[model samples]
Target: MRRNWAARLRHVTIDGLRAVVLENERLRVTVVPGKGGDVVEFLHKPTDTDFVWLSPQGLRDPRDHLQGAADDVAQFIDHYEGGWQEIFPSGGAPSEYRGARLAQHGEVSGLPWEYDVVVDSEQEVAVRLRVRTRRLPYRLEKTFRLRSGTAALEIEGRATNDADLPLHAMWGQHIVYGAPFLRPGARIRLPEGVQVIPHETAINPPARRVRAGGPWRWPLVPADGGGQSDLSVVQEPGSPSDIVYLTGFDEGWYEILTDVGMRVEWDATLLPYLWMWQELGASTGYPWWGRAYTVGLEPFSSMPTDGLAAAVANGTALVLEPHETKVLRLRAEVLA
Candidate 1:
């Protein structure tokens, strides 16, 4: 027998920013329009816990969103309010491709997105958010839907190129998880036969664990201390920050079981590659200052986070013909 649960959708303002709140028996999601239509809050009703990480800098008003930083990375960190963001056309550091300079994390994550309520009912709620890139001749649209009595979210997106020239791009979902729900003893499960590759640059401390540019099997990783650390289990806060990429997945899915048994499952078919970003309070830089202890399980269309130019050079970038459109489907489900 199925239980009837109260489901509703409402529009509200958070800190002077337009937001849409969708709630049901199992989940509550807050979508902010001004902040690149990012999902700032994803709360599981059963445990009253939020899976999304809120940056220490916190959310800022669109008016205060900074621009003209010395570089794109600086610009991105200045306005980033950790949660779930869509990176389009490029990822990683700023680079030039086809006469256009791409910024770190891309333009869509920082641009204002137009949203519309597609459906609002007692059984289900859906919304569509769309944005057009100012520097590129492309338009992106994403539709987020949630149904009653389920702890799952369905995301469908489409990217269309309007120009006559082909476009080389990288698309990724920056889904970050923070404390309380993400703690030590948490385990990650992925498809069989997956290979983990470490980043080339030694930007943070954890990079010292695996041989740079070397490929290792998933979960059991050789640490720099001459021992192995189960990469599947989450470490305590204040650990070193590391970045790695996962490939050779037999299937497109990964699951994370928290310390308390809360499970998060992600579909990887749409995105394919998983980028693991570990920021366990190791970043002592200007933005983090060693205060953030979060992990990003990002699914990307390409390898290497060195921006679009690198992706293209490595022949891993996705190319779209003139007037061509690509559609991607992703789902996130929680089990308590």
Candidate 2:
């Protein structure tokens, strides 16, 4: 008996933008090089499940789309067709660095990247993507690989500060999950001794259950109406939009299980903090209009979503001395 080609790499244009597809026997992963090198689609083929959440507005090419307003934050959110964005240099709100302003989640997520199909074999396939930030003196490179017979996608990345002066930046992986894969009964699993800290304020006040407090122990947090809300269990649709931080991880790994499951593991030292963003139909205004339901499991080198300036102020930002480079690795595996 002979085996067919188990791993392959292909390219296609998605919504007027170039995208690269890498797949094995179990998973099909799509990378959009023209839009921030985002992992727009991660499909578990056997189950026909896509774990990535796509914004209702869908992917829009910034080059072709006309802006309604001249806001920096809108520039990112208006085009935020949620998938998996590699946030760099700034992770949250717009902030100033050396008198230059960094856009919300800026310097990378909205910029186009250059990619090359570095490996194309029957047993494995890989692609390398590189990008240089427009407003910052930084260069980032990463390669994504998928191997035959494996359901895992491996990513190796390097971030370099190309300037002569020291640079501080907030780097993160903004991976989100939505409907079809995420639902009321879905469960989340994290490492032991993990602590959860709710954002001081709720993004959707009316729907939020967890009160703003804690370094609370794992899943159960003090609910607003005086009970404990379980963090491990996914809430029903129309629940609150909230933000929380998970810290004190002995290791960096998480599992989101529905009928199918996804397990993501990364270097804890490289990105020690995990931000859990729940926007399960609670945001009734602006971008979402209560139409989106998604959960973001983000790994970061910083805390809070207050941008690089805040990360630096709080001592959570990744600092690179002139010409220094930091390399990191992560893997996302699909489980049946």
Please list the C-alpha lDDT of all candidates, in the order they appear: 0.78, 0.84
Candidate 1 lDDT by residue in tens digits, 1-336: 222456678788887778888788989999888888889998998898798889988877544625743466766777788998999989888988878888887788888889998987778889999999988899999998999998888888899999998988899989898866888767777666666776863122132223222233233232343434456777776665677887665456767766333333444554667898888875687878988988888889887888888888877788999999999887788868
Name the lDDT of candidate 1: 0.78
Clashing pairs in 2: none
Clash totals for all candidate models = 0, 0
**Candidate 1 wrong stretches, greater than 4 Å:** 1-5, 62-65, 201-228, 259-270
Cα lDDT, model 2, residue 199: 61
Clashing pairs in 1: none
TM-score of 2: 0.91
lDDT by residue (tens digit), candidate 2, 145-247: 9999999999998999999999898889999998789999788888766666656532321122222222232332323434444667788777766678876
The best candidate by TM-score is 2
* Model 1 clash tally, residue pairs: 0
Q: Estimate each model's TM-score.
A: 0.88, 0.91
Question: In model 2, what lDDT does residue 61 have?
Answer: 84
